[model samples]
Target: MVEKWLVALQVILAAIGVYQFTLSLFGIYRKKKHKEYEPKKTFAVLVAAHNEEAVIDALMENLKTVDYPKDMYDVFVICDNCTDNTADIVREHGWTACERHNPHQRGKGFAIEWMLKKLWEMPRQFDAVVMLDADNLVSPDFLREMNNDLCSGARVIQGYIDTKNPHDSWITAAYGVTYWYCNRLWQLSRTNLKMANFLGGTGMCFENQLLKDMGWGATSLVEDLEFTVRCVKNGVNPVFNYKARVYDEKPLTFKASARQRLRWMQGHFTVARRYFFPLLWQSLKERNLAKFDTALYTITVYTVLVTFLLTGYMWVDAALFNGPNFPTLYEYLPTWLAVVSVVATCAAFILALILEGVKSWRVYASLITFPIFLLSWWPITFYAFFTQNNKVWSHTEHTRVVRLDEVHGKQVS
Candidate 1:
């Protein structure tokens, strides 16, 4: 019975690993053709800020350099429960500043829903709405690429999330490497395979019609992910636009990054509970492969915990029931296979850096220790399982204030 159970568990882990590896391979060879569409869609760029006085000014100034037409997009900053001068800075840039003092509803989801209602109340109706963080610098061609996606019939689009402070610290470098890998492997692969792309909190855009139809009702800890699941269930999968880039400031310290990820893992648990079954049911009822894919993707965060527990149990079982005929747990997985897996994964990370045009030698060196960062997720996952019900929003503080020119040393067109 123990041997049989071990085989089943190994098969499950192998399947997950193989599925992800296949996707990464798909991402590597896929080349998407870019088409320029006439800028016809009016946009309401919404920036959610909570006392982001340090970075809001830089973001506001960066928006001024966006290559899109002045009349095409309007910027609005939502200063939620901010005692700082976040609102004042937005007004200084001649952008509309919306101040909300609701301590009860403090997360980005509530702020977004509130802002959507505010936008509807006004006379100006937008064709689409772009969501962004206060601690971000938009690429010059951000809106233009989004416009191309919208015009090309993508209802919900996610932009490539780049790190603004990749070299500031090892934590940020890990984040930079991770985001670059995901952009190519996860997001781009899903797009190439015609599957749904999950939305990062920032750098997402939704059509006004879809927003009105679905409404910004996601108030979970990771509203972006919850909303993505909702969109998938509704038969409206979000697509990835690689050209639409948004540079986000990463958490400088490991502790800050861990806390932020803890909240995210907690939110993942919440969303999985709420939508996993529904997504599965939808896929079965409609025979939709996309919905099924989304369902599978939803539970992937728990993969680390599941694999850990199963392997640990197998090891203990092997120790207790050792015999000459019974092979140890380590014997089940060939050493060469494990070595190849690690090498292939490291090669992929290096490929991501080259493709993303990251030149810093230090950033490349950080990849050697990136596995430590990935391993850190184990404890976070365990803790999140116990505290998943605690939905308190813990915001990561952003202090690196860099201009658009400073990000890439040249404007992104």
Candidate 2:
């Protein structure tokens, strides 16, 4: 009976994995044919930077390249308690810069709220606000496309953010491939199907009114995800715009990646606990089927972690107790098939990297080591379970002076 149960569970898990894979492939297909939209109104580009002086120059240069009327659109950088020259760099570009020295409210959420309140107080304002990280570079037409989405009645628009340092190391390469696959396939398919998409940290646009009402009260680790969920529950479906591209630097070291991902995992777990019950109950009461889907996706983070643990336990049980005499169902299947599935997943990742036009052969070779990268997250996920030290806002250091020519052999300008 135990063997039968294990077999059933394994089969179900495998089927779900395959289904998600297929959905991702369909998303990639849809993304290829996505149309570009032009902006019909002015936008305010808000950047929250803390000690980002090294990269602020490139970011400012890219900001100037945005295809919009300079007099109409303005750039606002909120230097959140920075002891560095981040504020000075923004001011040097003749752009609007606000320096906040609040030691108590230190998170990005607080910085954004402070900026929004400041914008609201101004006599002249923008129709929409575009949020970006200090290390991010917007494409020349980013504002045009995002503005079009705003005119089309989309209160929230998410743009594609690709990594700029894929060739820095094996760790960065793996992250590049993962991000490329997700943006090109997973997000595209879900958006086409009218499903919800969580807001990425940057490359997102919001209506001025919405931000005014919400006040960025979600001062958590994954504030972007938390805020996105709040907007979805409030009847705002974020629209994904593949045409509006933003390039960001990836974490070049394992230590940096682990810290960043752990914070994300912890934040996700926190959100799951806080909103799952309330959202689930509200969805059922209102008979909102889409809300149900959002709730399921939000809850799946913890479920996937649990499933990984349970699967490992079953494998160990089969290996130790049911080896020869019991002949467990999983043991009957050819080991080569499991190996082949993993290889196929890697092949898909390689294909995605190639499709994104990555040129480094060494980076491509690092694709074989991708499994190691995936396994590195296990420790972080496990640690997140027992960790209640959510007070300290762990910030990832971004070194921006390194140009794309130095990393990838091509300069944007």
Candidate 3:
């Protein structure tokens, strides 16, 4: 009986690993065949910066180079309680700057809310509001592509955010590869399949009315995830635009990376607790079974991580403790097959990394150091699981000047 149960568990885990791997492969294929569309609308680009004096100037320069109508697109920077020259830098760029002094209501969510409220009261307006992080440098045609998607009736659109400084260190390189893989395979492919895609913190465009109706309530540390969930609950599916690219920096140090990821994990946990049940209820009430399944998967990160670990343990135990006298816990053949399935799943991850390297020359150098980048995540993941008290926002350190030419093969501007 115990042997039968072990076999069943191993088989189930193997199947899941195979399924995830297959999805990733299919995702990469779909990304290659993605098409681009242009929108006939304008955009209001809103940036929320907190002590980003170093990077704000470059961001403004990149914003100015965007391939959209100058009359149709305008930049708005909300310097959220910055004790730096961020506001002055924005003013120097001849852009609109809103200085917000909110000590209690910290985090990007609050910064976004304050900006949205201020924008809502303005007489002059845009068709859609594009939200970007202060550190991001968007591609020239970003606005054009997002506007195109919006014109095609997409209420929300998420753009591809690539890393700008992957060569900074091994940790950054690993993060860069992961980001590329997620965006190119997971997000773009899922979007093509008509599946829900979460809004990344930056490079997302929203219909003005949707923003107004949603009230821009920023509460979670991972505001983007919460916002995406909220939109889905209200019957809005975010569209993914592969042509819209925004390059941003990754944490250079392991400590910074861990801090950033902990915040994300914590925010995800918070969202799972607060919105999961309500969203599930809303899905059932609206008869949207598909949406419900997506929501469940979004909140199942912890489960997925736990299952992966359990699968590894079972494989090792089966290999070491197999004998006729002892009598194995699971069917030996299925257990071996399960081990093979796990290996195949790892192959899929490597394939995704190689494909990303092929897509961009800048990432190729970092790919050699990918293993080091991955191993560093284990400690961070372990810490996140135990440190349930990580609610306070830990800001990532971003230096003002970037080695753009060395990393991207050309100056950003």
Candidate 4:
């Protein structure tokens, strides 16, 4: 029984691995000739800040010089239960600032919903709305790229996240590589295949109507992800605009990374519970591959669970259950699939680093140890399973602010 079940598990793991690898490969070779579109849409850029005074000044400075028309967008900042000068700085700097004092209501989603409510009551109407974190600096062309997509009839969009402090530590280096890998492996790749891309909590844009229609109430820890799936269910597909970039801070310490990733893993499970079955049903009922793609995307963590369990089973089988006639686990793993699983993923990461033009020797040098960082997720996954039911939002501390010109030593478009 154990032997037979092990075979079944191996097949499932291989299938899931191949699916991800195939999508990544398609994303790598897939390129499109983008048609030029006018940047005519007006936007309200929303920033949710929680005691982010350390980095607020830098983001404000970056926003002031964004390469779009001055009147095309207005920056709105929300100081959610802030005990610091975050609200004061925004107000002092000649920008709109809203103070959120409700201790009962926390997290970015609730804060954003409150801000949207305030905006809905205002006299001005916006064509689109963009959400950002206070620890981020926008590329000069951030609004322009989003405007291009909005004009092209995209209702929701996500921008690329470039790490502002990649060389801060090895932890940060791993975080940077992961983002670069994901930009191509997931979002850019999904965009290439004409599928909806997931949203990074920061640097996401939605049509004002959609925002109002849903009341900006995706209050889960993974609000960006929850909202992305909600958009798909509502028949709205999000487009990825790689040219629109936002530089965000990464946690420089292992403890900080663990805290942040735990929140993410927990929130992912929260979202999967509510939407996974619906997505699967839609895919079967409508014969929609895209819906199925999103469904698979939601449950990919199961692959990790299976991977860990299979390793334990193989260990025991080899030691005690080996009948001498029993085949090794490696023999069961398909040769081509096994080779592609390891080779393709690493190759994709290398290609991403090259494409992103990261020149720091430290960033490249850390690639050798990046596997250790990736393996950290396995333990984090189990940690989340124990703590997922706890509903508390623990924000990662983000004081690091290495500006674009400082990191790359040149102007970035």
Ranking by lDDT: 1, 4, 2, 3
Better model by lDDT: candidate 1 vs candidate 4: 1
- Residues 1-413 of candidate 2 have per-residue lDDT tens digits of 86577667667666666766666665645545544455467788899898889888888877887778787689999899999998888989988889999988787888888888898899987888999998888778788888777877888889987777777778887887788777866677778778777688899999888877766777788788888778878988788888888788888899898998888888878888888887788889988865765676666566567666765676677799773443334486898978887777767777666666667676667768888888776667778877835745677889945543354452121
**Candidate 1's residue-wise lDDT over 68-178, tens digit each?**
899989999999999999999999999999999898877999999999999999999999999999999888989999999899899999999998888888899899899
User: Mind giving the per-residue lDDT tens digits that candidate 3 earns over 303-323?
Assistant: 545555555565666688652
Residues 73-121 of candidate 4 have per-residue lDDT tens digits of 8999999999999988897777898999999978898999899999889
Between prediction 1 and prediction 3, which has the larger lDDT? 1
Give the distance in Å from residue 2's predicted Cα in candidate 3 to where it truly belongs: 11
lDDT for 167 in candidate 3 is 66
What are the clash counts of all predictions, listed in order? 0, 2, 5, 0
Top candidate, metric lDDT: 1
State the lDDT at 131 in candidate 4. Answer: 93
lDDT of each: 0.87, 0.77, 0.75, 0.83
Per-candidate TM-score against the hidden true structure: 0.93, 0.87, 0.85, 0.93
Clashes of 2: 2
Better of 2 and 3 by lDDT: 2
Off by over 4 Å in 3: 1-16, 31-39, 281-290, 308-336, 357-379, 403-407, 410-413
Off by over 4 Å in 2: 1-16, 31-39, 281-289, 314-344, 354-359, 402-413
Clashes of 3: 5
Q: Which pairs, if any, clash in model 3?
A: 3-329, 38-148, 39-147, 39-148, 54-400
Model 4 CA lDDT for position 390: 66
Error of 2 at 379 (Å): 1.5
